[model samples]
Target: MKITQKDVEYIAHLARLEVDESLVDKFADQISRILQYIDKLKDADISGAGLMAGASLQNNVFREDTVKVSPGPDVTLANAPERHEDFYTVPRVVG
Candidate 1:
């Protein structure tokens, strides 16, 4: 996990960045430490752990479905500011 100045320079070139020459060594050292920390995480033990779950419920649980009839567009759009041809109209939102 040891990063060199050359590696930093190459990464900067690939990213189209204008890294200062004086900061290359600093970046290499910081990257090396970060990679070493990540490498250490690979050794974590989790044999007894289960998949992530909710605090109060288990996975794959669902409620019963119910059916209902729609109240029509008149009731749905009653409070709209503007309407045309069974649809609501608003000012252009995007440029």
Candidate 2:
């Protein structure tokens, strides 16, 4: 739980952080405190704790399945630069 200056430097190197000499001591102390809190949590009992399936209470929010009429072929093809019959026409690239 007691994070050393070397540990902080190693962590900074692994994370690709450009830590100044003045901030290394501060970061080491903060990381040590965090590890101490985790060590404290190891003593607590949670044998009966239930696992959470989701983050929210709401579930299965879905709309009814229904078919809707789309725009007519003329309206759909109106935006195309070139069209043949009811489809858009483009240059063929395959040999």
Candidate 3:
């Protein structure tokens, strides 16, 4: 899991990043430590654990849908800055 200077440079090139020359060594060391930590985590035992959807006990806590009357155009267009009859008007975007 050792990260080299060349590896850092290659990663920077792939990400289209302009990594400073002075920070290459620092970045390489930090990346190496991160990879080592990940390797350590991979070695942990989790065979006894059971996979669950979420941490909470509740599932699908939503209200049931019901058909209702529409509010109509008056309430919908009341706050509009510019309206043309029942439709909203805006500046022309395309020529």
Candidate 4:
């Protein structure tokens, strides 16, 4: 888990970043400390904890199926510039 200056340079290279030479040591130290903190989490007890399916409590998320009336062609095609019966007409294009 110890992050070296070389490791920082390698990470920067993988990310295609131009990391300044002066900040390499600083970044290495910061990353090493963060990894050390995360390593300490391995000792945490979780034997009594329940297995979580998800964070949300509610499971039944579906809505009830119901019939609805349509607005019909007249109201639907009212905004069209050119309408034939119940449809909007567009200019045909040839390739």
Best by TM-score: 2
Rank by lDDT (best first): 3, 4, 2, 1
Give the lowest summed-lDDT range of ten residues in model 4: 86-95
Per the 3 Å backbone cut-off, how many clashing residue pairs does candidate 3 have? 0
lDDT of 1 by residue, 1-95 (tens): 89899989898999999789889889999999999989986788978979665686655778778778988999999988999968999888999
Q: Indicate the TM-score of model 3.
A: 0.46
Which regions of candidate 4 fall more than 4 Å away from where they truly are?
Answer: 46-95
Runs in model 2 lying further than 4 Å from the true structure? 48-54, 57-95
- Please give the lDDT score for candidate 2: 0.90
Give Cα distance to truth, residue 63, candidate 4, Å.
14
- The Cα RMSD in angstroms, rounded to one decimal, for candidate 3 relative to the true structure is 8.8
Each candidate structure's TM-score, on Cα atoms with residue i matched to residue i, is 0.44, 0.48, 0.46, 0.45
> Tens digits of per-residue lDDT for model 4 on 1-95?
89899999999999999789999999999999999999987898978988888999887799779888989899888899998888888888776
- Going through the candidates in the order shown, the clash numbers are 0, 0, 0, 0
Measured on C-alpha atoms, candidate 4 has an lDDT of 0.91
lDDT of 3 by residue, 1-95 (tens): 99999999999999999799999999999999999889986777888988897899997799769988989899999999999999999998899
lDDT (0 to 1) per candidate: 0.88, 0.90, 0.93, 0.91
Error of 2 at 92 (Å): 39
Q: How many residue pairs of model 2 clash at the backbone?
A: 0
